[model samples]
Target: MFRFLRGLVLPEAACEEANSSSRYENLFKKLDLNEDGRVDIAELHAGLKALGIPLGKDAEEKIFKTGDSNKDGQLDFKEFMQYLKDHEKKMKLAFRSLDKNNDGKIEASEIVQSLKILGINISEQQAEKILKSIDADGTMTVDWNEWRDHFLFNPATDIEEIIRYWKHSTVLDIGDSLTIPDEFTEEEKKSGQWWRQLLSGGVAGAVSRTGTAPLDRLKVMMQVHGSKSNKMNISSGLKQMVKEGGVRSLWRGNGVNVIKIAPETAIKFWAYEQYKKIFANEDGKIGTVERFVSGSLAGATAQTSIYPMEVLKTRLAVGKTGQYSGMFDCAKKIFKREGLKAFYKGYVPNILGIIPYAGIDLAVYEALKTAWLDHYASDSANPGVFVLLGCGTVSSTCGQLASYPLALIRTRMQAQALLEGAPQLNMVGLFQRIIANEGILGLYRGIGPNFMKVLPAVSISYVVYEKMKQNLGIA
Candidate 1:
């Protein structure tokens, strides 16, 4: 594993530094950016800048004069070798200086102090974030081996480059592949990036839900009209929608759907991050079970917060054209007629569904991620796109399947108040009524449309999410 990480970071550093014939080759290649096998003063300056080493012109000139034995303004292999020896000696001294306690490791405070000396002002939080990246043993400190391996190839130290390399490093077997991106340190949770993460999640959710809006409308129609005179099958449902309000009708209720997604995703993501912190162990590691619990709680919290939008969405989907003009109008009518309880009509079943839905979803996804990592990504850390899609689709499907019946019940309860002469039923009464009227299979009335939408919806969602992160330079 150590050798694998070294290869990813410094592919040429195979042999130990104690008895290596070509120890300076990787260093030389880094300095020789054009790969001309020679290090010019310009290349050296750029290399030092990349390494976060601020060398003044005079200091650079001094090194160039000492290393350029041939006096050709460039250092050949042998000349570069001499420079490399001096560079390592300097780095060793610097590392020792930072190891203030002489414990052969750099702690967060020590690193912060060293950075301050270099005119870099960083909080202890930032210091720990940096150390945690290189801390291989979970000790939250950088050992000599880790320190040397990290700086072996003279990796970039600028914040932008650091983030990029950190993400790139995930593609290599530097260590475990289960590092949760959403799991935040105490410091990072309060950082500006927290808001950015929430915003990204909101955008991803909106895009995914909107992309699947047609099928979502179909699902609602099937759930409500499957047993009515409409006899809503997918084909009939689509036809009925177009007949009613044209192609645009296919996206009925999508406005509320899209609006609800932003807050739902942002709340869920933020809550999940917080819950993970609360549930994490002393080591600050959250296990799979804890993750599932956190996800379930987060889902429920988000659902409860935006549940009125869900109710409004359902009413608009099943309502006739003259029934409600928009989401606000729908909410106004529901509140005026049925009071506040109308907005939470299906609160029982909706909240109930979160348990199985979130539990199964998270459990299945984590299991699949672990399986892919163990089976295929054991050799290479990052799995292929197809693997991720397969896992996401299957896991989401299984989760939806487990909770679909409850979701159908919730939808029915939410829309029940809108149907004239239909009795308002409690959770148990609704279950019995569905069973008596449409049989047990009635609970899964819209399942086909729901299933049909899962793959594409989840695929697009994940794809957009990844692209967004990459674009934002977060990934």
Candidate 2:
């Protein structure tokens, strides 16, 4: 069941691993700039960076020496293979180091002692929780097989690579949310076919937005008018939209919504990479906090760049019949009548919301991923699709919970003028009105529809993104 779930949620990694050896060979060839049969220190350094493994100078030198078994100052195929073999051996020794008394299995007590030596400062209960995950026999002890399978699949030998991969691949319950690293791999960067990443992201965004357009439209309506109209709900909102503009009204703002996805995603991706470069350490690796900061800044940059489209989208959605023919008309009318400030009505809340939503979402996801790795993952590097789904669901749920009120306020602010009889409320004024008129719960108006969209949206985006990458021949 676990294997099945993993295959479902993380098929990309599973399917891609089958061709990993070939991919590695191809990667090696790409790194061999001079077409030499052996790889020198310079070539190896370049190759690791190309593979997204950024080592500091000393670390790089150490890796080179480790691989050059014959003291040849470079790595031949034999030496390279030996180095790979040695990495596995070193990891096995790490496992043994945890098993005190030369025992074949590790108990919770052993875990506590080992973690203490590393200054982890965990309680025995926490140690037991960690052991419980890989305790296949339910004896509350991790046997040789369990220990080996749990840590052996990871390929990084050096601490830098280990921490980097751990930060990227596993989620850590680090109390607060941080950013998830970019999904693109080093091989994808080396391919110089960058458009594929943008294409995949754009397609994923489009598909998610389009598929959930109706719910989105409904949510907008509810946010703007639900407090005034107590009868408003999902079904009534749908009926109201159809009555106002016809069944097609459900997608009134979809054009602008879809239009902004490509550039937004591309810009965010680029900004994120640049930010990563900026935040990276001497080893060319970034910590989780750095990743979160980079991601938040990137999101803010993308949001600011494409904010006008968001305004246009909201206007189109909230517009009454004959108010505007299309998004262009809506944009033109807003610019001409309301001026430039109109396009930025909800900009502050929107930007502010990104921090909590992205931060909490990222943090929770990393925490969940870390917990699963600590507990359930053995043999398989991935905990599986179900685990991914759980992480996303929980993270998104928490993020939405934290940011929903702000989002509601932003939506109301954006569409305030569109509703003829509605009062114009600034950020603080809007919060006051909502609280006084409809109570705190009013702040969560239309959240049901909003929450309903999360699962399908995330699933579609992830699955489509992966499929598109494969179809585009991205490594």
How many Å off is the CA of 46 in candidate 2?
36
Alpha carbon lDDT at 255, candidate 2: 87
Question: Candidate 2, residues 65-92: lDDT per residue as tens digits?
Answer: 5677788788777666566557657766
The predictions' CA RMSDs to the true structure, in order, are 11.4, 12.1
CA-RMSD of model 2:
12.1
TM-score of each: 0.66, 0.66
Model 2 lDDT, full chain set:
0.68
Clashes of each: 0, 8
Error of 1 at 94 (Å): 20
Per-residue accuracy of model 1 over 65-103 as CA lDDT, tens digit each: 667887988888888767656655655665786788999
Every candidate's lDDT: 0.67, 0.68
lDDT of 1 at 111: 72
Steric clash count of candidate 1: 0
What's model 2's lDDT at 230?
67
Q: What is the lDDT of residue 78 in candidate 2?
A: 67
Model 2: which ten-residue window has the lowest total lDDT? Answer: 169-178
Best model per TM-score: 1
